[model samples]
Target chain A: MFRYIVRRLLQGVLTFFGATFVVYCLMFAGGGDPIQALAGEKPVTAQQRAALTEQFHLDDNFFARYLYFLKDFFTGNLKSYTGRDVFENVGSALQLTGKIALIAIIFTIVVGVTLGIVAALRRGGIFDTSSLILTLVVIGIPSIVLAPLAQYLFGIQWKIFPVNYTFEKPFVSLILPGLVLGTLSLATAMRLTRASFFDNLRADYVRTATSKGLTRFRVVGVHVLRNSLIPIITFLGVELGNLMGGAIITEGVFNIPGIGGQLYKAIGLDDGPTVITFVSLLVVIYIVANLVVDLLYAVLDPRIRYE
Target chain B: MNEHLLEVDNLFIEFHTRDGVSKVINGVSYHLNAGETLAVLGESGSGKSVTAQAIMGILDMPPGKITRGRILYRGRDLLTMSKEERRKVRGEEIAMVFQDALSSLNPVFTVGNQISETLRKRKGMSKADAMKRAVELMDQVKIPGAKERVKDYPHQFSGGMRQRVMIAMSLAMDPKVLIADEPTTALDVTVQAQIMDLLAELRRDLNMAMILITHDLGVVADVADRIAVMYAGRIVEHADVHALYKNPAHPYTKGLLESIPRLDAKGTELATIKGLPPNLLRPPTGCAFHPRCKYAQDICVTTTPPLLDLGGGRTSACHFAKELLDGRI
Candidate 1:
């Protein structure tokens, strides 16, 4: 198991490098002049252009710039294109996004799995049908639509919560939009849990448990639920990564001072360095989340071994 | 004689499909005595497993229903019993071990926990006591290192070992009757022999009546006291094991016996039963097996034959039982 974990960790590191390299290539090779975007659309002389190129290290070849980026990225010396320290500006935003995403994931799993089990146990009944219909409706509506609706209902109409921009009280700001972002995931998790649990209910082991004269609760709980959670866990892990990447719209709607909001501001100002830094950070988080999921696979199922 | 431990008289089961309600087990009747083994033998999809499931009270309700039946155990009709009462009688009075041992045991649980849970629930034993008894049951089934290896999950054990775990679990409650449904079909030949031997020994030690359900005639030859050959959800032939093997009165039984590959017939083509069992949804108008019977006559196609007593407690459901007895067919 230790060997398996170490091997997975190494693979994760390699995967992170591959992802970062893609982001780096896209930023550099793609036809976009960061200097012009930062400086504006005004006409400039050749000497001024050369000076801006030198300042941003664009004068060097692709390989040299890549090497420098890699060295600084590893040494914690990341700097934005506007000459601001990237680590100080972007790092804290990444941390805040991580916390919100983590909380949303936890809430989604607990509530989603509970509703799923309830629906499955009462299959074809009112509770099951209602839960299924509700999930479908929630998943059909995009977060872009749900976020404004949430803000309108909870913030503007009811006046029960703050309207926007609550960095000082992050938890208060997190509620409305976090819930808006989490709704689709909660629905997805519930659907997955229901399908997996029902599949397990039809398995022969469950029948065997029943034949042993086990109570219905024990049969469903110990035999059916544990085996069913395998697929649900896998899907939840992927959903966690998606939530981390996709919370931008929700953050923008509520104006939360997280990576998502920062990303929006950077994109509006066309700040290429800040965009690359934040997106690369997200890629790293996604890769690490997947790594943790792989590790959990071995833990949840004894049949899976690292070696 | 200890009287009948279980009696099923005129049991009828039906399945509801998109087409209509189709009868599967049509008025099948049988009974089991205490401390005796009755082997129910048939081809696949002959409603053998469904009958077993009905008796265990585990049949899926919406699709499957006991349309008409009387399943009497200890003089109480189990069909009319409350759910709780039936559940209480299921593992405590009558336990079942299913086919496909690997799939039958819960994969996530330890063998010891699965066995001990039944013991604790039915026998009212504490955890430590149940574990001790579970180990003993494991030792009885010849699972090596029962004390230490009890914590192993189902996948950790081999097919034969998993079957042994299943047997140990069934025997945990000291049930009066044990039903093993094709228990050895998933095993290799050598392991099949070992499981059959272990079952025979356990049956003798526990002195419990057993219902051994299998399609293999050779398997039940040594273990079963009485053999009931089922065809198309009906018992076509019933007799003592020696009598049935020595002289099969029904055509389906004869075909089944001749189909078994034997070393004595080296270099000779094995006898094969022609055609499959009739689809229960639209079975033949008269006898279900007439379409597949070599000696099926006009009367066999137009009218169903009743199970007739041919003296000496033997019965055969065939139009030409006399012809078979007289070697006229």
Candidate 2:
């Protein structure tokens, strides 16, 4: 197990570097001049352009600029186009995003799995059919449409909660948007959980357990639930990665001051350094989340081995 | 006369399908005496396994319903028992070993845990006591290194060994009857013999009545005390093993016997039964097997044959049983 952990950590490092490299290539090499966009309609003289180019190190070759970014990234010297430290702002944003994702994931798993079990146990009944229909409806509606409507009903109409940004009570601010973002995911997880649970319930081992005179609860809890959890866990991990990347629109509407919000702002301003830093951070999160999922697979299923 | 351990009287089962409700077990009746091995032989979809599942109360609900039946164990009607009460009787008073050993046991759990859990539940044995008995049961079934190998999961065990584990699990509660449904079918020939031997030994040791459900005549010949040949959903013939093998009364039974390939006959195409068993959805009006029976006549196709006593503790369900007995097919 120790060896496996070490191997996984090493793989995690490699994946981080690969993600960083891809983001760096896409932001710098693939895109046209950021200075042109930054200058905008206001005409700039040759000296102004030259000074601005030198200031941002755009005068250097592509490889040189990439190496410079990588060095600064590791050294915590990444700066925004406005000359502010990128690490401090990006780090704070990441912390906020992390909290939201964590809370959403906890809510998704607990409620989703419970509802799934209830649906599976009472299959073909009113409760099962209703829950299945509700899940389909939620999954069909996009977060973009759901977020503003949620803000209008809960924030504007009821005035029960604040619609715009307020960091004083993070949990309160998070509840509406987080739930909106999490609804689709929760519905998806619940559907997957129900499917896997029913499949496992129909398995011969479940019948064997019943034939052993085990109570219905024990048969479901021990035999069916444990076997079904592997698929749900896998789906949760992938969905988490997706939620981290896909929270941009939801966060933008709520103004949660998270990495997703920061990425949206940087994209609007056409700030190359900020975009590169935030996109790289997103890539790192994706890679790390996938790595954690792979490790969890081995933990949940004994059949899987790192070696 | 031996006392009856289990008796099934006028048991009928119907399955609801897309087409319509089809009767699968049509007034099937049988009885097993204490310590006797009763073998029910039939082709696929002949309602043999359904009978076993119905007795266990594990049939899928909504679709499968026991329309009429009295499954009496020790003079108590199992059909009338509540779910909880039936559960108690299932693994403690009577247990079942399924046909596919490979699929029956959970692949994730250790063989010992599977057996011990049953022991713990049914016998009120502690974990430690159950574990000890698990090893003993594994040993009884002739599994090597019972102590060291008990921790291994089901997948690690071979097909025959897995079947042994299943048998061990069933016997853990010391049930009065063990219904083994094609226990040796998934195994190779040598492993089949070994499993049959182990079952025989366990039955003698526990003095438990067993119902060996199988399609192979040769398999039941050595283990079964009585044989019931089922055609469609009905038991067409039943007799003591010796008498049934010596002189099969029903035409279907005779055809089944003749189909078995014998080592004594060299370079000969085995006698094949003419047609498939009748579809249970819309079975023939009279005798279900008449379409496939060479001795079938106009009377056989027009009138149902009730099981009639043929003397000597035997019964046959055929329209022309008298003519067949008189050596006129």
Stretches of candidate 2 off by over 4 Å are A1-15, A29-52, B1-3, B122-124
Cα lDDT tens digits for candidate 1, A1-307: 6787688778877877787778778766666666676778787678988977787688789888878888777788877777788778776786667667777888788889899988887899999999999999998998888888889998999987777758677777776666677777899889888889988998998888888888888888888988998888988888888777747888888777688888787776656567777887887778778878887876777677677
For each of the candidates, the C-alpha root-mean-square deviation to the true structure, in angstroms, is 2.7, 2.2
Model 1, A266: alpha-carbon shift in Å?
2.5
DockQ in order? 0.58, 0.66
Q: Which one is best on DockQ?
A: 2
Angstrom error at residue B80, model 2: 0.6
- Backbone collision count in every prediction? 0, 0
The sequence of per-residue lDDT tens digits that candidate 2 reaches over residues A1-307 is: 7787788778778877787777777776656656666667777788977987787798788889888888888898887776789878787888777777777788898898889988988889999999999998998888788989899999999987789658788778887777777777899888888899999989988888898899988888988888899989988998888777648888888988888888887776667678888877777777778878888987776667786
- lDDT per residue (tens digit) for residues B1-329 in model 2: 45478999889999999898888999899998889999999989888999999888888877999999899999899999898899999888889999788689887678899999977766678999899999999999989999999998887889999999999998888899999989998989999999998898889888999999999998988888999888788999999999888878888888889999999997999999998878778889888888888877898888999998999778899988767767677
Native-referenced DockQ of model 1: 0.58
